[model samples]
Target chain A: MRNKWTKVLMSAMSASLLLTGASSAAMAKAKAAPQPVVLKVLYMSQQGYSTAVLNKMGAEFHKEHPNVTIEFTYLPYPQLHSAILTSAAAPVAQYDVVLSDLIWTGEFAAKGYTVALNNYIRQYIKNPKGIPQSVWNGLSVGGKVMAMPFLANFQNFYYNKKMLAEAGFKSGPKTMAQWLHQMQVLKAKHIVQYPYEDSWLQAEGLVCDYVRTAGEFGNGNLFNAKGQPIMNQGAALKALEWMRMLYKDGLANPNSLAADEPTAANAFASGQAAFNTNWTFVTGIMNNKSESKIVGQGVVSGFPVAPGTNRATLSASISGFQGLAIAANTPASLKPWAWKWIQFATSPAVQAQHLHSEWPIWSSVATSPQEKHLNPWYKVYQQNLNAVYNRPAVSNYLTVSSIIQQYVHEAIGGTIPVKTAANDMVQQIESLPK
Target chain B: MTSMPVESPPKRATLRHRLFRTLSGEYFWLYLLLLPSLLILVAVILIPMLFAFQMSLGNTSIVVLGGRGTISNQWVGLQNYLSLLQNPSFWQALRETLYFWVVSIFIEVTVGIGMAVLMNQSFFGRRIFRVIVFIPWAIPTVVNAMLWGMIFDGDNFGALNDLLLQWHVIQSPIVWLNPSALFPQIPWLSNALSYLGSNLAMNSIIVGDEWKTLPIVAILVLAGLQTIPHEYYEAARVEGASAWRQFRQITLPLIAPVLTVVLILRTMQLMRAFTLIFTLEQFGLPVLSIQAYQQAFSFGSFGMGSAVSFLIGLIALVIAYFYIKRLYREEL
Candidate 1:
């Protein structure tokens, strides 16, 4: 009887061991499979693809990756910086992916608020050669790519064709001197009072216009290669004097002292002014039948340069390109999925569809016939891109911008001499924390 | 008085019972009732204020961009304040703030009283008129600001310009807030008032603020007016006092307390007038409130921002103390 009991017990132990091993194997298999993930994305609402189109793209991304979901939030361009900073500072970041302006890349990367994307770009991107080297440099910090280039844009010159014709001009002005002369003629001919409209409000718009104008005068670079400000010298100083002259002579709209980008664009759109320079978003607004009175009259061109300055290769139009960065604090488990979405969304294939509204970041997509056919101003936009100027990429660019805005605006308003304002602006910028 | 019931001094009570009785006393309950509000006040107001004060004493700025959102600080006591004192911009901002405060309050108070007196009289559509007066106040500050912004806009499409052109009162549009155009050219005065900012810009802001704030002040004064007894006025008339005389002697003195309260409240509000000015012209007018915001957010110099904010609080406190003391003496 003892022998029979021992054999039965051994059999029971063997069967239990088998069952436990099978269960453990099944659990391991389940763990290896993809788990459900939800990613939150933030984008600027003022420009770029509409939220509806983005939502559709997100849905498509979800279909391809069955277990992942994408959630998106949109804020205006001005609010995006603050929101990005606030979210990155939170205990657990509020966003997994964020759209950042070109100006913010340095600051965001330097702070470790955004993750470096060099490794991911190498492993994931197929045929990355299509992207321009400058585009890559714009999205990098300390020689590491910190973001993926999303939208390519610059301040393109917009004008009313009829107004130019009325002033006896056949084409847009190629130099600042010519433009000023044309504006004077238009003003004297009673064609348009204050022939040029400007968004010289005390904000980033002022800085962009200044940079573009400085570029026209010569070098638009605010800082030298050694990262020291040269704004009190050379082209930068000349730009301010020219701007002040415009305001003093009443060649530029006096209302520009308080106008923002939209207000300036509206002035051109309504045919109240002959010429304006603004973002590519104005392309749609200028020619829209419902939004513009100059639907067929508005024409696009490369930004004008100073007469003595070289206008051959680059016109120095300030580039307002934007890109995507993953939050540094995003969970490791979720980052791969986040990258997947970014990779898919900013892919040349998906970006090509929005060419009419936004400039494509990929050169291959940019030169495609579809893009040129969709955008009538494709030739001018392309020409402007050849000579685009990126704003100073310092970590404290916004602070630098604020100082410039204040002094430049004061100078234009005639509160102080242009030389004094320039000198003071440079001094304040130099005093910022390194 | 009826004899109070004096009960037992009989048995020795246990310690727990004595404690319970003590806690159940009226004073304990009164304190217990105040506990929640006191806790809320400490957490919401006192604690943050203390933090702000502490921050003002050091170079404590939120260096989010470079430090991953950590607050970077170095103890540099009184430096922020001293620097602010020396800064011309700060002084200019302070001057603008006072200008905004004094000018707006005077307009609101004077217009408010006139409105209250007019509304106090028996008139047709009195109810409708009251509602109409309240409409500006009821509309949000931002909406009111935008409305006035469009009205005062320099463009030909602006309401004021369109109206002026239609009436042939002006042949061309006026840049209502252009600082250069608005700067007074008195040789002696120009240099002194160089940093006083655009009078026209400041005036436009004051006008917008007055239009929105007048209704509330009128309504408040109207409430005080209603509380007066009719017999006093009747008695004044019987005594053969003139209408203006009655108003000067009776109405003015009687409504002094209400007016004092309004003045104190409006003074505080005007010192911190941010939304109206910001919506109309952001950083266009470098008033104290806008300066504080710019220092903190734009420049990320939270230390300087705190110093400015702390100074503003001190100024407000000094003014309030004067008002309170005057009120106390008046009561005496």
Candidate 2:
């Protein structure tokens, strides 16, 4: 009887242990599994570069989390901003992540379309210091970080090295006068059809170009401390005059007035023009063997200062940085995942891998040896970034940009005198409510 | 009363009998049949237009992206319209639009008539020719604009520039689409004329637009031509009347009504010309439609944009009314 009783007790203990172990295992599995989420990311279509990178990153993320799915919708660059704004304003959240333009930070934030990313960056990102202060400034509004800067873009002076060399200059011009002289020499020698080309199309691009030019000449400030327009000042007038002279003297491409950045880049890449003033991505585009006739013949330098001003006085070219932001309407359940995705995408390693296409935003990625090997133009881009200027960040930036574009375009086109155009731009911008 | 009650009381009309009489009445079924169309018209046209006018009377910058979803308005009677009227760009756009409307209609009608005359003829490959002519019309307006944008590209690769250069027609390439470049080419013109020289850009746009619209106008005129008895032409031939005379007298008078219809339609289309101008010139050569689009979408000034839209509609209505009145007068 004692033997039988001992056997029953042993059996009961063994069964209880098995039940405890199985229940624990099941609970752990359930805890480990993430809630199924589908994140829709809205970004500009850059011929599949953004889509490809995002897809690869998303797949890797999915492997670890196992339940999150990523969907991407790409729009043309011009349409993407409006699309994001429209989607964010919808009753239900349409996009979890939006690849936002740097200039839109203030407008998006003020309109309450994007959530402040300060907390997320602090908690999720390993090294928030990786992103440069300048880039961070570009993505901040009301002293709060609104986005994760993914791509750093600013204008760089790109010259045809072969043409410059042939023109008896070993490097790009340093001043406005020197640049004009070199262009004249280039035109006289029949080395190039046009000495310079610009993407001065009457769009936001024209606003960017105008701001950069005006800033370089006008003591690095296009606005007063009160945000009043100073583009009608003497220095700004000189900048406008210089642009007009280029058109009048036939130094710049006649089509430059109508050409956007892509068209201007094409003009330079095809070896039709000796110089191109454009963003850093043109380096990779012009260097690509399939796209360019001037492969290995293109070189970069800082944009020329006005004749009297030195490089130190000249402000940076207009910033065209693109960043990623979470929509304010994003469900609270998905905020953590969205923050995680942003952290992963803008991390140093991922940025380094896609440095050439997306121009690294993080200082660490830019300085890394691996990225240096990948993008030879990194140093030049970094130098240009140092001198970058940005358009006034305001809730009415789009309207203000349109007004600036109209006046500047009219000035360049000679539809109105430069003085009139400048005065009109100031009066119009000032007339807007504070 | 008791004696009168012996007679049958007059029967009162029943509701069913009245309903039957109404249904059987003349034009009742016709009105019933038209109910669906009237409802559709109200839904698609009248409601939106009325809403737009109401919105224009408010001082609302309700950008869907920039505002809460709620439709809130700050009532400011006629403020939007007054502001638009006072704006210089509005005046400039109005001037440019008038020029565009007049020039496009004239060119399209002239070219359209020529095409209709040709297509009206019997030929071996007439079907193939008709199809070819209609291809541009079949293309979406935006696609047509893009097509012409490439063709008129100011670069070395542009087909027009390449052909001109190859033929040694010019020493350098012409920036066909750049208004600024095209302006200086005519030095003899006055400053006002020089200012209007951007009309050359409009001319290029008109060419593309005409190519697309010419086919429809031609088909309409061709239909009118078919209606005219060939017997008239045969009789005129026997009478020794020249082809020009026949065209001037019989052909023209017969097609006048069709041409008038085309004129009114094309004028309205040109006044509301947005896609082609927006795609090609954008704000380069601002017009009423482009201005409305820029104000609405680009600037998010919905009230001002709606005001601009109604202005265009009013202008179109006035012009269309005059044309219809003239047609009536001609018929009388």
Candidate 3:
């Protein structure tokens, strides 16, 4: 009877141990469950990925992370900068993630508005695999990764092949002189009254166009290694004078002085102009039946070189790429999830899926045969990316850009001389608050 | 009990009676009734104006102020004002604002008076005409600006351009939104015209502003016109006074008070006019309000923006003071 009692006691003890172990394992899993988080994100409504694509991606992200939710707010491109600045001034961040323009990376980072992603990149990204060095250079400020490369864009040269053929040209012009000659013929023949449509308005569009032209006509960089303005002389001066000549000689549209990018795109898409330079997004607009009159006749090519200039390896388009960044004031608990959202959004697979809307930041996806097949402009975009005139990464870049815009616009408007405009631009930029 | 109550009531002043006596004093209840509004005015208007003045004396950004940091650290007394005085953009913007004010006020008063007189007549479909005149005023400023922007667009798709083309007014489209392009290319005339601040762009803005602003002035003037008895016109008609003479002597003098008030009010509104110009021309027109907007919002320089704001407020106040003084003097 005693032996039977011992066996029962031992069996009971073993059963209790097994029960405790099972319960502990279950409790640990419950503890490890992710906390629910709602991340507020801000993005530009125009250009880059559409809201629908981003929403679809958000839904997919929620599928993997059932505990996380993404809330989005869209503003126009100009308002996005102000909104981000205004919101970041708050103690608790209003947005957890923001889409930052490449031009704003320096300013945003310097203001401590965005969190550095170096640690997150090291932990999650491991290898940036296909992102180009130039892209990283744009997203980094003071050797700190302020954002993740999200979209790659540049000023793309778009032409009407049918118009050029009618003007007795087989292919697009390889140099500015050749393009000018072709425009003259097109104008003389009355095929198109204004052969070149440019965004030379008194805004950022003017600066972007001027940068590309200066790169093609002037020296390689507007600022030197010491980060000083050198646009007062050399290729920059010539580029400004050439732009004035285009407008004065009646080769460029008279409305070019008042036109922005969309206006230029409209003029090109409606078969009103034979040659135009605009963002890569214009390709979609030019080919879209609803938005274009000469849909299939539009051709995409790298920016042309100035006459007597040999830049075989590098092209002279402005780097108009953008990035995804985490706000600095995001709560510590929500930061990890913010990084996850950025990672998923910028992943090569996701970017490749939406390749038709925007160019992938990954060099591999950009050059992949599948992506190339999907976007024929990818080939030309790759060539344009070879050497782009990156607006110098300065904290005061907006002020600098504004000064350039005003002077260049004055020159184009015939309110000031080209040399005086160039000299005044340098003077004003140098005088900006440090 | 009656004798005791009469004796006791003679000696004491009760708190309720004393309070009632105080309340019955001159304008006490009037001020007491206005307490809520006064509090609101102090909160919304007085506090912000004072704070803006404080900021105007400093060199700070919205970030610093928004973060609740001590602005004294960034203080540079009167430097913002001094710098603004030296800034060429500020002078240009001031010139544009003056031009806009002079043109808009003149047009608003003249057109408003004309509309008021016409509407005062016993015409058929008068009610419908009044509503049609008010439709532009009822439309939101943003929507109106956008509508006008589309009409003034320098594209082939623009309404004005398309209409002009269809009507055979011109063989080629004119770039209406650009001042330099819209003006004739004659050297002497262009230079003279530039000095006068009479660009097509500003004139286009005035046209849009007048469409929306005329009704308010007209309604005010109409109310004033109604106050003048029909007997006055009948008396004048009984005399040898002509129609033009009667209008000049009777209508002009009678509506003068309302017109002065409307002009002063419109001056304040026009000096702060930003949405119309900003929406239409963007950075193209650097008027005072746009300058303030750019400094505060675009450049994030709150100090400079506040200085610009204070200057605008001071100008409006000075003009109001002069007009009000004249009004009181005329009354006396």
Which one wins on DockQ?
Answer: 1
Interface RMSD of each: 3.1, 3.2, 3.4
Question: Candidate 1, which segments miss by more than 4 Å at Cα?
Answer: A1-33, A311-314, B1-23, B63-69, B181-194, B330-332
Cα DockQ of the candidate 1 complex: 0.30
**Model 3 over residues A72-130: C-alpha lDDT tens digits?**
99887767887887777667778889999888888877767787889888888866857
Candidate 1 displacement at residue B168 in angstroms: 2.6
How close to the true structure is residue A349 of candidate 2, measured as C-alpha lDDT? 74
Q: Write the per-residue lDDT of candidate 1 for residues A1-434, one digit (tens) a residue.
A: 99999999999999999999999999999899788899999987865577877887899899999889898998867567767766765656688899878788788767677888889999999888788766776677788787898877788988888998988999988888888899899999999888888998888889999998898888888899999988899999999999999988878888888788888898889888899988888889987899899988988888778766755654667777777888876777778888999999899998887776578888899889998788877778777777777789998887788888889998998878999999999898898779
- What is the C-alpha DockQ of each candidate? 0.30, 0.28, 0.28
> Over 4 Å off in model 3, which ranges?
A1-32, A218-220, A307-314, B1-33, B62-73, B181-189
Tens digits of per-residue lDDT, candidate 2, B57-101, equal: 886553334322323467788988898889877887887788788
Which has the higher TM-score value, candidate number 2 or candidate number 3?
3
User: Cα RMSD for candidate 1?
Assistant: 5.4
**Per-prediction fnat values?**
0.24, 0.29, 0.25
TM-score of decoy 3: 0.90
Candidate 2: C-alpha RMSD after superposition: 5.3
Question: How do these models rank on TM-score, best leading?
Answer: 1, 3, 2
lDDT of 1 by residue, B8-46 (tens): 564566666777777788668877888999999999999
